[model samples]
Target chain A: QQQVKQSPQSLIVQKGGISIINCAYENTAFDYFPWYQQFPGKGPALLIAIRPDVSEKKEGRFTISFNKSAKQFSLHIMDSQPGDSATYFCAAGLTGANNLFFGTGTRLTVIP
Target chain B: EPEVTQTPSHQVTQMGQEVILRCVPISNHLYFYWYRQILGQKVEFLVSFYNNEISEKSEIFDDQFSVERPDGSNFTLKIRSTKLEDSAMYFCASSVRLATNEKLFFGSGTQLSVL
Candidate 1:
C-alpha cells in the first residue's frame, strides 16, 4: 500500500507543448503529495505539492491534478520549455509518517 | 529557501572499510533522514531521526548501520563495514517537522564508491 508507480519512464515534447507525467498510489492513507524536480549533480527540489483535500493545484505553468477516488495524480507542464527538462518524481506521505514513498521517476524533455 | 547540505561530495573506499556519511540539515528543522540511490534505481529510505532519537527505519537499515546527532550542527550515518553493493549516492534530508504540512528538503548528496 506504500508504493507509488509513475508512468511514461520518459517523455519528449516540443517547445510550447504540454508535457504530462502520471503517478498512482495504493496507499489511501496518504494525505500529502509532492512532485520533485532534479537536475544533474543537484538535489531534488520541491516543484509543487497538493493535499488530497483539493482536486488540483497550479503554480505558474505547472499543474498537479489529483483524483482521490482513482488513487491517481498527474503533473502537467504547459508551454513546456527546454529549461523544464529534468527528472521528475512523485511522492506521498501521511500524517505522522516518517518516510515518503517515491515513484520510479519520469524524465521529461522539451525540444526547442 | 534553506536546504540540507552533505559533505565529501564523493568518497571511494575499499570493501569492508568503515564509512561515515555526514549531513547538516536546515538549522531549525526538527526531523532528519537518510536516503540512498543505487545507480539506475529509485531512491530508498534508510532512516529517520527526530528529537535526537530514531523514529523509524527501513529494513535496509541493519545492525551495521547507525545514525548519530553527535552534536547540534550535524547528523551522521555510520556503516561499520561496507560492501561493493553499498556503492551509491547518499542523500540527507530534513523537514520543519514530520507532519502532513511539512515537506522534506534534500541535500545535493554524497556519492559513495566501494571498491
Candidate 2:
C-alpha cells in the first residue's frame, strides 16, 4: 500500500514565478514531514522539514504548509529559479522509527 | 559536510550471480539503512541496521537479501541470487540519531543491472 501520495508528476514554472507541490499521507503516527531535493544522478538532499506542531514553516524562499487534520502538506517555492529545477520528494516518518515513507516525487522545471 | 560514500557507482551482473554493494557511512553516524528506487518509482526502504544487526526490514527484504557491517567503518548489502527485477538504484543512508527529526545523509547510489 502507498503510505504517501503526491500529485502532479511533473511541473513547469517560469523564472521568478511560484512553484507548488502537494502530498498527503495516511498514517496518523507520522509526526515528521520533510522535503528532499534531488538533481540528476545525485542522491536526495534535505531541503526543508516541518513538525506537526506548527501549521507552517518557512526557510528563505521555501515554505512548508502542513494540515494535521487533513494529513496533508505542501511545499511552496517563491521566485523560482532555473537552478531550483529538480525532483522534489515529500516524506513522512514516525518519531522513533528508522524508516520513512516517500512520495512518488515531482519533477519541476523552471524555465527562463 | 560529511556524506555517505558508495563504491562502484554502477554494476552489471548476470542473473543468478551474487553481488555485494558496499558503503561507508559518515563516521559518527550510529544508524544505517538501505533504500532502493526503480526507474520512475518512489524510493522504498529495504532494511535498517544498528549495533551490528538489522532492526527493521520491509517485505522486499527477503531471504536472498542480507546486510552486514564487516568492520567498524564499512556496511555492505549482498544478494545471493540476482534476478532481472532487481535492477534499481540502491542507496545507503546514515544518521547520528534515530529521531524522526534528525537528518539522514544518503550516498549517490549504486545502479545495479541484472541481465
Candidate 3:
C-alpha cells in the first residue's frame, strides 16, 4: 500500500516539553522517509528524515525514530517552543520515484 | 539557497472555465513535480516532469489536467475545465537529482478555487 498514516490529528504541548507524532506505512518499497513542517501560509519544509536501515536520526532538537519491522516512524521535538506550532507531515518515497506519499498531517500547538 | 516559486497566490474560477497554474522550480533542479492538497487533506501527487516530458502521473491527474515545461524554467499545470472539486492548494517541487537521500524544495503554492 502507498498510504502513510499519521496521528494524532492534533497535539498540544508546553514549553520545554517533548512532542511526538507517529506514522505508519504499508509500502515496503519506500526507502526514504522525511518529515515536513508547514507554517499557516507557507509550503512544507523539510524537518528531519531517516532511512529504514537506521533506527533513529537526530537533527538538533528534532529526532526521527524509525522502525523497519513495524513499518512505523515518529518525530520527536525537544524543548517545544511556541514558534514550533505548525502542521507537520510525514511522507514516504522510493528511490527514482516521481513523488512522495504524504500523511494527513498533524497540527501541533506548543503553549507557553 | 534557491527555492521554487509559484505565481497567483490565489485564483477563483467558475465551473467549466480553463485555468493554468504556473511554477518556476529551483533553477538547477532536474526533477519537477506538481502536488495538490485539498483543505485539511493530505498532499496528493499529480504529476512529475523530467527532460521536458512527463515521467509519471497519478490517477487524480485526468484528461482535463495537463502539464507543460513551456521553456527551460517555467512548469505549468493546465486544467482545461475546472470543477468545484478541483479547488485546492497546488504545490510545485523540485530535486537536484534522483536518489533516496535527496530532499525536495517546494514552492509556497497556488490556491485554486473553482466555483
Candidate 4:
C-alpha cells in the first residue's frame, strides 16, 4: 500500500513566482512529515520538516503547510529561483516506525 | 555538521557475484538505515538498525540481502547474488532518535551496476 501520495509529477514555474507541491497520506499514525530536495547525481538532502501539531513552518525560501484533518501537507517555495530546480519528495514517519514512507517525487523546474 | 559517508561511489559487479557496500554513519547518531532508489524511481526503505540490532526491515530485504555492523563505526550491506535488477543507488542515513524523525543525514550514495 502506498500510504503517501503526491500530485504533479512535474512542475514548472517562473523566477520570483510561487511553487507549490502537495501530498496526502492515509496513515494517521504518522506524526512527522519531512521534505527532501535532490539534484542530479546527488543524494536527497533534508530541506524542511514539520509535525502535525504545527500548521506551518518556514525556513528561508522553503515552507511546509500541514493540514492535519485532511491528512495532507504541502511545500511552498517563495520567490522561486532556478537553483531551486530539483526533485522534491514528501515523507511521513510514525513514532513506532522509524522508517519513512516517501511519496512519488515532484520534479520542480524554475525558469529564469 | 556530521554527515554519512559511503565508499566506492560506483561499483560494477557481475551477476551472481557477491558485493558489499559500506557506510559510515554520523557520529553520535544511534539509529542507522539503508535505502535504495532505482533510476527515476522513488526512494525505498530497506532496513533500519539500532543498538546493534535490526529494528525493522522491508519485504525487499530478502534472502539475497543482509546487513551488518561488523564494527562500531561501519555498517555494511551485502548482496549474496547480484542481479541485473538489483542495480540502484544505495544511501545510508542516520538519525539521533527514533522518537523524532526530524533530520536524517544521508551519504551521497553508492551506485551499483549489475552486469
Candidate ranking under DockQ, highest first, comes to: 2, 3, 1, 4
DockQ per model, Cα = 0.68, 0.76, 0.71, 0.62
Tens-digit lDDT string for candidate 2 (A50-75): 99999999999999999999999999
Q: For candidate 1 chain A, which ten residues in a row score worst on lDDT? A: A1-10
Better of 1 and 2 by DockQ: 2
Cα-based TM-score, every candidate = 0.95, 0.98, 0.97, 0.94
lDDT of 4 by residue, A2-112 (tens): 888998899999999999999999988899999999888677898999998899999999999999999999999999999999999999988678689888799999999
Considering every candidate listed, which one attains the maximal DockQ? 2
Tell me what TM-score chain B of candidate 2 gets against the true chain B.
0.98
Could you report the Cα RMSD, in angstroms, for every candidate shown?
A: 1.4, 0.9, 1.2, 1.5
Q: Give the alpha carbon lDDT tens digit for every residue of B1-115 in model 1.
A: 7778899899999999999999999999999999898886777889999998999999989998999999998999998999999999999999887835687889999999999
lDDT for each residue of candidate 4 in B17-99, tens digit (9 for 90 to 100): 99999999988999989999888777899999999988999999998999899989999999999999999999988888872
Please give the distance, in angstroms, between residue B50's alpha carbon in candidate 3 and its true position after superposition: 0.2
Candidate 2's displacement at residue A44, Å, is: 0.7
lDDT of 2: 0.94
iRMSD for every model? 1.5, 1.2, 1.6, 1.9
Considering TM-score, which of the candidate structures 2 and 3 is the better prediction for this target?
2
